[model samples]
Target: MYDVDTRKRALALVAQGRSLNSVSKEMGISRHAITNWLSRLEPLPRTPPCVRCLESPGIPEDTAAYAYLLGLYLGDGYIISKPKQHYLMITCTASWPGLVDAAEEAMRKVLPWPSVNRLQRAGCVDVKSYTRHWVCLLPQHGPGKKHERPIALEPWQQAIVDAHPWEFIRGLIHSDGCRITNWTTRMVAGERKRYEYPRYLFSNKSDDIRKLFTDALDTVGVEWSTLARGSDPFNISVARKASVALMDAHVGPKY
Candidate 1:
């Protein structure tokens, strides 16, 4: 009878693209025995159980990725959970391909078991990951739009956001925020001078989501304020010089 070690060696050789005959000859095992071992090899796991749904029900191991994903979801992410369809989608602008890649990567890091793909829209790319567990991971899934409903984080999710504030902020900025430089010219000592104002702006129609962003900014000691162009006070501006510097250091542009 072949021992476990021998069986493992033969299987390893076969896994490395070696033919059954070659493995049998190299390991001094019969072809029938090798075939039997291969057949008995347990099927690889299809999809791992959601860590947040287990009996113990713990937070995701990659809290940083989870936090970032949470921010992206709050900003421009969508979840469709139904009897026939389920997935998590994050919309990224086609102009910034890097954000699309980052969104896909964050989804993978948070839930590596599912399949992630990019769908190109008219002017944007949708990074989608298929899994019903997304609803479990993000309880904010509901029937209405994000701004139309109450979006709040659970205790565990809040803990992750608090722990990785920068990652979370980065995700939000990458999804719905922008670092823009507005400039003006002024006559200084009879010479035309250019003054550049570089700042970060996070815009969302949901009041709760804007509050969450401000709360995270507060946690990170980044001063921010609200801006209203006409009547919609849906803009959070991190235009303070110090705060802008801090944002540049951590969350910079969405490239």
Candidate 2:
């Protein structure tokens, strides 16, 4: 077995952009040994949060709908696992019943055999589905706010997003975003006048999630602004009329 210092030196040499073979030759170690060490240094395999989530898989990795569900899951979804069973829950504000319905439909399209239900809590509705494939779809599943910890997309997930960016944005915004009217007053001909305009706002407490939201918007050519409302959740808004219209064409109100 290679000593820790030897392994560290090999990795550091690679970090300086040296070839594995050259590093091995200089260190009098085999090139295969360096290659094996590099492989061992990679991230641990992301296992399912729950073993049961792997039993009966539904949903393939490449579908647009599946990608949409993934965006939704990253934004507002969570998974619960008990021995022998597991459930995927995408929580939405009670006010957005249509969004909840849409989430249900998406899940149904992906998992035909599982029944989807809406569970109403005090101020929210959970679009819940019993599925064993939830963890397989979202290996990033973990406890606490997504931004509080590191968040990243797997290669397959990124590929799906590259192909279906709009659908993924739709899922993200519909779940945590809103198209609301912004009202303002101004002096018109020396008199105060009121006017209203509509914009889209995607809010979340997680900075990482917010970045993901903005990145998706950029990919789709939608212009937006981000704001932190005095300790309130940070949000990105597309307030320009042209940009708002563009977003409306893609991801407007769920209802």
Candidate 3:
């Protein structure tokens, strides 16, 4: 078994944003050793220690275990690409009745055979149905098509996203879209609800889509400041800009 102190140090290094490879090299340990320790530990429940806490009068040994657990969970864990793509595309059919089937068929025809082969190699596959008129595609190691951007959320915004669960992220996107619909109804009575309007609606879950971009940043330790005034807690323009910047970082080109 690994010593508790060693595990604590490893956790601290992770919080500092050191990659597993780098940490293993610097500490003269194997990545497997770190992974083994992390597997044995539980995630931390409370907020993580700030940079100050890590640098300040050192963390307690017991606290270190919790901190390590938190670090491992909060830190970027390894994403094992099953030779099969494990990602899913969930489209909301409540608005676009027949769009999902159309999208799937179109994708199959338009996407090159090699592209499909790559997806299969990555273990990615497309799933669909015609009767339900709603379809979800599960691509194994699906193309990195979504992750084409560097995240640019402020530290606090990132924290809120990190602190909350994944379900919360899904809820936020759905709720935010709902709010946009509410605003649209008030501003333009004749216009159909945007959510129901298929053309303008897009899945915010795409890796390139930054609906939860702010949350991803928080997981990596960015800080966001609260606004002094405004009905919306976040400044829309700033958030959008940050998201766009993140996309450019990951995607290699802007959309």
Q: lDDT per model, in order?
A: 0.86, 0.76, 0.33
Task: Between candidates 1 and 3, name the one with more favorable lDDT.
Answer: 1
Residues 1-255, candidate 3: write the lDDT tens digits: 567787877655544334577567767889898877667776323224432244453322323222222222111111222321211222323343233343343323322110111111122222221111010111112234333434233443334335543322223232222212112233367765443211111123333233453444355433333332444343222224454344324321101
For every candidate in turn, the CA RMSD to the true structure comes to 9.5, 17.3, 19.7
Model 3 alpha-carbon miss at residue 185, Å: 13
Q: Pick the candidate with the highest TM-score.
A: 1
Clashing pairs in 2: 53-132
Query: In candidate 3, how many Å is residue 214 off?
Result: 14
Superposed on all Cα atoms, model 1 deviates from the true structure by an RMSD in Å of 9.5
Least lDDT summed over 10 consecutive residues: which range in candidate 1?
13-22
lDDT of 3: 0.33
Off by over 4 Å in 1: 1-46, 185-187, 190-192
